[model samples]
Target: MTLAFTCKKCDTRNIYKISRVAYYQGIVICTCSGCQSRHLIADNKGLLDFPEFGRNIEDYMESQGESVQRLVLSNTGVSTQDSSTRLSPDDSGNES
Candidate 1:
């Protein structure tokens, strides 16, 4: 099975080839192919959720060490920047 999610940094669609059981783990890490940014998805006490961009997901994972398994997914295609979800330090940061 494959899990799909948008990259928070570049808004690219990241697809991971993982089993259903792995998808429901306490935490899941995915590296974006477009911008190479690390994303952290966690289970907030039974609430499965994916954190947004600029949340320092990688920092948290690094702290976890081997306790967490990093799942690096591949991109099925090229990424066209999504204006609605681009991570820009500037105001709006919408790329035209």
Candidate 2:
């Protein structure tokens, strides 16, 4: 999975790529490539560390005055804008 967000401190755009395992872990810590600031990206979990910012990529970018663009890409070179395709760790790779 790839995430593109802007740093609040440096205003630099950061692109982060992670594996499916990391994505399903539900917590991602991205380091700003420009200012080297550590940011915590998680879902529903409150602040726990001393990161410069603690929020999902969307919220963080919104706070930084950047519009959120959500896109999902699959291995078959297919892309979609469906947010309901969210995957969980327990997903069995089968459609019900």
Candidate 3:
């Protein structure tokens, strides 16, 4: 539940708990009036406001052994001149 704001101009990050005004709403301006100058450079958002991406808990449960098999196949493919092995990063922070 950490509330944070990225200065749109300078990219300076700010964190807040509460404010006198309601400027902390989604995609709204930072409390600091000076931040307005950076409006085009950064976005103010709470960490939770960012989109949830990639695999989820269900995917993890399904992928356990299959994912490792993919890696082994990919390693074998890499030895070939043209490997059709293109994989994306997984939720565990490794190549899939």
Candidate 4:
């Protein structure tokens, strides 16, 4: 099976090949193809590790007329929009 996730550093989507090794390892560590940043894959709590991953898979399967099981990942209704709008440390606090 293939697992997908977004790179936190570069904001790039990545796909990892899940294999027997992952099961044996308990926790799989993956490096981002885009930014080369490392990330952990947990044996459990995959939904938390990759919140949008399952949803992406669901969309693809539906497009192909395949039935897929839904996984509820997120519990917190926290908004990402506010975080995205925050100014970087280097910002001069000016909006243009």
Best by lDDT: 2
Local distance difference test scores for all models: 0.51, 0.67, 0.36, 0.56
Candidate 4 residues 1-96, lDDT tens each? 456777769999998776745534355668899999876554343534564333344443566686644222234422234343333434566667
Spell out the clash pairs found in candidate 1: none
lDDT of 3 by residue, 27-47 (tens): 333354545452211123433
Cα deviation of 88, candidate 1, in Å: 39
- lDDT ranking, best first: 2, 4, 1, 3
lDDT of 2 by residue, 1-96 (tens): 777777879999998787656554466788999999987775435546534344465666677786766776565333347655555434657776
User: Candidate 2 deviates by what RMSD?
Assistant: 9.7
- C-alpha RMSD between model 1 and the true structure: 13.3
For model 2, what is the error of residue 63's alpha carbon versus the real structure, in angstroms, after optimal superposition?
9.8
Candidate 3 local Cα displacement, residue 94, angstroms: 24
Model 2 clash count equals 0
- Put down candidate 1 lDDT per residue, 1-96, tens digits, no spaces: 455667757889988765455445445567888998976654433443434322233344566562323333234332223322333234455666
RMSD of each: 13.3, 9.7, 16.7, 15.5
- Give the range of the ten consecutive residues with the poorest summed lDDT in model 1: 77-86
By TM-score, how accurate is candidate 4? 0.40
Where in model 4 is the C-alpha error above 4 Å?
20-25, 43-96
TM-score (all chains, Cα) for each model: 0.38, 0.52, 0.23, 0.40
